[model samples]
Target: MENPLTPDALLAGVRRTRLVAIVRGNDGPAAGRAALAAMEEGFQYVEIALTTPGALDAISEVRASAPVGCFVGAGTVLTKQDVDNVAAAGGQFIVTPSLAPSIEEAAGRGIPVLAGALTPSEAYEAMNRGAAAVKLFPASIGGPGYLKALRDPFPDIPFIAVGGVGLDEAAGYWGAGAIAVGLGGPLFGDAGSGGDLAPMRERARRFVALATQYDGRAAAESLR
Candidate 1:
């Protein structure tokens, strides 16, 4: 069955939210709870990475519990089978750590994909291959300047900075033209430690505030 959420809608949601909370941990239940906490704190997009133990089940759990209009997607997707599994588990989107055939597979199934890329060539290739957006992995290494340079030539391609994206850096990436920002450890914290969720909620609130502020500023500037 085709997902009710279309690629265009997913893309628009990403642009509107501008923050993607990446949930990963050893305990599936904890991961699910963390996702819920993030959603409760106003994050509309969540990616449950396959690297987490029982991540598929976690995805299903979060999907079943997340409020309406929230997007639950599968992260670390590497194969066509992963795509099928995520779709079966009610994932509305796919996020890969690298540019792969999986992007094409997701596109074939009408599922939007954000494939990871580190260079201009890789990003462009991923876009050409049907990725809904390109995730600039380990973005901290290049920081916002690198993303700005990448956008210089291919301004049309949507970019999502992931891997090492701190809460403080969210606005910088948005200002640099990123459609959205993906955060893992910085957002969820060490889920393995069984820490309190209050910190996560605080972090989520901070990120959301920064993204909203920058997004509004950009929109206002566009009008002028």
Candidate 2:
């Protein structure tokens, strides 16, 4: 079987989750629990935010405990130090809230960096930076239509839709050319207060099911 959690394999996991929960809590335990729940719920990609306490430790712990198919990534990485931290923690990929030049430096080592972008120009520049994919952040404000518009000119770039993306709108974004979607509070709620993870797991499972259904339809059409 092909390995799906490798840095190069993040895209497949993206289709499965369509919703990556960014978790940052008071300590390693909280982050681990949140990340564990996300994986249990069928989410293959989990991001432990750099702002969280012991983020790298939490990532290493989660990476060790998570099922083989799960992809653990570091989020909100801003500097070369953050990149080194995640890499040392064994994180397969890195995600930033905004495009940064340091991100290019990190990705050069074969680590997949999902650089955030708000415009076509930004997205194109991010791709030029050797980014594995461009994250369309605050996508709600831009909307799925914006992604579709961007695709007309820069269709080859892999776009991960982020922010304000929920089950109700995931399909719209995917249909509009988004390769994946990143979700937060809606899926996991607040980490500081510690959410009821069982419900979040169910919600994540439903997202996988919904994305699978959409993929089925799309594949069928393509075969015709």
Candidate 3:
């Protein structure tokens, strides 16, 4: 069955949820399981990083089994071939850790692409090159304050705060004007280490609750 969420809808959903689970499992099965677990805890967006082993297969598995309205995307995508492979694997979107021409390919296919950028120049360049959004990588280095400052200029550009974002920091990113936060180890933990998933599920729930709380706050502020 075809995914019901379109590129624009996917971006809107990310903004609505304000949380994206970055799944980097040790293998395909682990990645799929982690994605399902995150979804079970109310995460509507999931990004399967290509750096993971068998990531393409993992994306296919997660997309096949994900429930309706769940958006599954490919992350850490670096090459044009990677973008095409992700599309072939049923990925609904694309996320790269750096600026790349492959972003145009994803956009050409009507897949929303979030290209990484740390500076205002890079962000503008990314948007000009057809990125649906700009992902602030290693966001912890500058933290929410940095993101907040970046938003001052590019008020219209959607920003996804990725890398080193903890569960407790998710709301801070939202408050900093980020459209969404991408969480990896802090949310999924080392699921590949044969650890218990119950704790991870609990963390995921907490992250969702915090994100939703912030989303409500943002909505209220908009009304004022």
Q: Pick the candidate with the highest TM-score.
A: 1
Ranking by TM-score: 1, 3, 2
TM-score of each: 0.92, 0.88, 0.91
Model 2 misplaced stretches (Cα beyond 4 Å): 1-7, 15-19, 191-193, 216-224
Better of 2 and 3 by TM-score: 3
Model 3: CA > 4 A from native: 1-3, 192-194, 215-224
- Write one digit per residue (lDDT tens) for candidate 3, span 5-82: 566887788888888888886777787788878888899889888888888888898888887778788889888899
The superposed Cα distance between candidate 2 and the true structure at residue 93, in angstroms, equals 0.5
> Which regions of candidate 1 fall more than 4 Å away from where they truly are?
215-224
Candidate 2 accuracy as TM-score: 0.88
Model 1, 5-104: lDDT tens digits are 8878888989888888898888777887888889999998898888888888888888888888787898899998998899999888999889877899
List model 2 lDDT by residue over 1-224, tens digit each. 11225446676667555656778766666777888888887777888888887888888888889886777888898888887778888787889888886578776877778899998789888988888788999899979899899889997898999898877777788889888888776676764236566777777777767766776235323222
**Candidate 2: global Cα-lDDT?**
0.78
Task: Write the candidate numbers in order of decreasing lDDT.
Answer: 1, 3, 2
